[model samples]
Target: MGLRPQLMDSTRSQDQDQNSTQDATALIQQLEQDRAWLLEQIDRGRWQEFRLDLAALERELGQLLQRASEHFSSGSE
Candidate 1:
């Protein structure tokens, strides 16, 4: 009985981790797409308009990547 509950809890934890990883991946992909779109607009002479937005997006992406790296590394341990 005790072992069964422990196994269930472990399974739940793994499910949560998988969901979190998927969410993070989706977010990163979206951010990359947004960055590419912004760059395309800039190339078409919209630099001034999207410049600040691009910078912010880059910072957010960097932070997200850093957090993900840390999270996964720690999980591996």
Candidate 2:
């Protein structure tokens, strides 16, 4: 009986990990897109606001990666 619950818990954990991985992958794709946009903005000599937005997006991506790293590292235990 206890084993059944343990097994279920393990499965749930695996699912959560998979979900996190997917989220990370998606975020990376978004980051790439943002980077391309930033490059284009730079080439076109866009306004300062676009530059600021790019900076903010880069910081956000860094934070997200750090968060995911912490979650993955802790989850292993």
Give the per-residue lDDT of model 1 (tens digit) for 5-77.
9999999999998888778767756766776776677567776767777768767776776687677557656
On lDDT, the leading prediction is 1
**Model 2: lowest-lDDT 10 consecutive positions:** 68-77
| Model 2 residue pairs with clashes | none
The whole-model lDDT of each prediction reads 0.74, 0.73
What is model 2's C-alpha RMSD? 3.9
> Which runs in model 1 stand beyond 4 Å of their true positions?
47-77
